[model samples]
Target: MIDIVLLSLLVVIAIAIIRMKDLFAVVMLTGIYGLLSASFFVAMDAVDVAFTEAAVGAGISTLLMLVVITMTGRKEKSTRHKPLSALFVVMLTGGLLIYGTLDMPYFGSADAPIHKHTSPRYINDSMEEIGIPNIVTSVLASYRAFDTFGEVVVIFTAGIGVLTLLCVARSQKNDEEIDSINDSMHQQHLVIRIVAKMLIPFIFLFALYVQFHGDFGPGGGFQAGVIFASAIILYAMLFGLSTARKVINQTFVQVIAALGVLLYGSVGIVSLMNGGNFLDYNVLSSNPIAGQHLGILLIEWGVGCTVASVMVVIFFNFAGRRAFQQHKKQAQDKESSAC
Candidate 1:
């Protein structure tokens, strides 16, 4: 009865949120949707998945989308109410989901086909095949390590995409131009700068812990990279881009970011060459355990570097573009005066 009520409330909220016309309201509703979905997942006993959805959808994803919305402005004008392509896509996907569900075991059945088949093998063989205590981790890092590696590649690609889309290099030029146009707009915050400087080192140390502690807990490359990048972003926001650049040079940062991906890819290639399958980390060290540890470490570091550098690059580019724009404007002003 409680489940039914909660589910009904979720449905009602979803309808209300969907009817919201304001884009700002929609963004807020997205957060609400994330929270509700996470709640539902938790109720279903999928805590890990729920935690991820809550953090990503509510925290990072929403923040990122808000930033983009602020940068790009609210909304595009609608051409028509009819969305034939959208309708077709939705219909096709719904049809597929229904078709798949039709063959699925009945909900809450103890003797369901799902439980009767393959479940025993998973319960029994997991210990020997993977040799890990935690079945989930064993599956993710060992048995299904390939899938996780693919995900890491996708993350690396996304970092590259963000840098490219945001015109990180051009940001410097933009910054100069902004300064020129808004010369009187320059504001100082010495207190914040000092505070940020004090915290920067500690922030980085925590990021290191998160990156290295993935074997035992929920921390990992994705979290570590984002945390490190966020610290730099904070520094820039508080102190100024010039100060941030002094700490992390643009050219060197880009090289490290590229190197991270190369490092990860190289490990896989090395394993392939060592007579084991691709990414078979057993070749990294004499002991299988040591090799697995080494591989995880290398891959995690690669992920951290790429995530941190690419994020910083995006922030720098945005800030840089403003600076360049300001600089250009100043030059124009001087030329006009000379005329």
Candidate 2:
């Protein structure tokens, strides 16, 4: 019953998103949709996925979208092109996707191929093999460590791509007042600022707990990283970007991001040197279980570091770009008024 209701709400949100014209409202609705999706994940007992959806989808993604809207504009532009062809393509794709699922086993079927195959090993043997209480952590950080390494690399690459596109040159005139989108916000939201300052330290503490406590619980590096970045983002929102920059050096963040990837890769190389296959944790220590524990811990930390730094870097670049454009516009307005 809960599943049905959540699915229905998801469908409604999807339709609303398609129909909505106000980009700001659309972004807000999108965040709500993410929250609902995360709730659905929780109902399904996938708490780790729920945490990620809530943090990345509902929180970080929404902020990035809002920042982007500052440069793009508040309202969506009306297009002159007809939608008939696009509609036809979408219908075709949807039909094909539904068709593709026809031969799949029903949800929660114990006899499903996945359950009969990999799930059994993960469920029954993972504890003995990996010595981790959490099977998801065992699978992701141990059995699938290579895949996780690739995921970390992908995140680092995305940060590099954003940096390339949105890199803003620092202004030479340190004393000149720069107009910022957050200036009015910081001044107007005194209560929010006070409450956020109080909450920020607790948020950081929770992020650290999530980062290190994954072996026995629902959270791991990815969720923890986003949660950590979010606290800094909140600070920047309340205190202004310049102050946040002083607190967190952009160059140091970039370095940390790179080092994280290196750390993950280094574990694999060390395993190889120890006469084990790449990412084989068994070779790290005489006791296989201890090696697994050590390897998982290191890689998870690497993932956390990379993810947190990348998220912050992306936010900083987007916010900085928006500030630059605003400053340029203000300067142009002043010049025109003088003329």
Candidate 3:
């Protein structure tokens, strides 16, 4: 009974998302839909899945779409599509879902086929096999660590891709153009600047906690990385780009980014030197428990540092050029007026 109501709500929201006229409004609705879906998943006992959807689906995707909108322009063209084609695609997807649902297990039944096969092994052996209390953590960080590492690499690649696309200084003309755009905001928002100054330190502290807290809770390198980067971005937005640059020098940001990966890689090298497998943490400290904790902590810190630095670097490289150009134009305008 509850399932039907929730599924109906999802379908209604999905339709609304498509039909919304305003681009920003549609984007926001999509985020709301994602949050609702995450909540529903949590109600269904899929906590980990809900966490990821809440974080990535609602949070990251919305933020990124907003970024893209800002970089391009505020408005979106009303894209006209053939109604028949849209209907065909919808029908095809719905048919597949309907077919798949026929084979799905009954909910909340202890003797379900899925529980009989997979859950028993993990339920029985997880504690003895892995030291971690959280089965998901053990699965992610130990058993399928290669996949986690790849996910990190993929995230790194995404930042790199954004850097390549937006951060890299393409042409002198483009630089000049960016500077021109930046000049429009010469009169700064004093309130936001003061507020950001007050908040940055606390944000950094929170990021550190999130980085190191994964052993007991649902956080790790990835969450820490995003959190740290966001703090820097807030600083950049509140203060002028040049002032922000003064605080986090371009050279310094680059060095820190490079150092982060090197720190991570160096851990593995150290493990190898200690006559252990790559990234094996037993040899990091005299006590294996202490070593494991230290190793994970260090890697999380490295990830946070890199993510934060890289995000700010992207903002600066792409947007800073515009600000610089704007300042130069403003200065020239004043000089000409005085003369």
Worst 10 residues of 3 by lDDT: 178-187
Question: Which candidate gets the maximum lDDT versus the true structure?
Answer: 2
Which regions in candidate 3 have their CA more than 4 angstroms from the true location? 1-10, 41-60, 79-81, 109-130, 168-189, 273-275, 283-288, 314-339
* Evaluation by lDDT, superior candidate among 1 and 3: 1
Instruction: Count residue pairs with overlapping backbones in model 2.
Output: 0
Compose the digit string of candidate 3's lDDT tens values, residues 175-286. 4555445445634676766777889999889877766776677666666676676777676665546556667778788778778777776777887898878877768888
Q: Relative to the true structure, how large is the alpha-carbon lDDT of every model?
A: 0.70, 0.92, 0.68
The residue pairs that clash in candidate 2, if any, are none
How well is each residue in 301-325 modelled by candidate 2, as lDDT tens digits?
9999999999999999998888788
Query: Comparing candidate 2 with candidate 3, which one achieves the higher TM-score?
Result: 2
- Candidate 1, residue 288: Cα displacement in angstroms equals 1.9
Better by TM-score, candidate 3 or 1: 3
Residue range 38-60, candidate 1, lDDT tens digits: 78777876554665567556655
Residue 285 displacement in candidate 2 (angstroms) = 1.2
RMSD of 3: 4.9
Question: On a 0 to 1 TM-score scale, where does candidate 1 land against the true structure?
Answer: 0.72
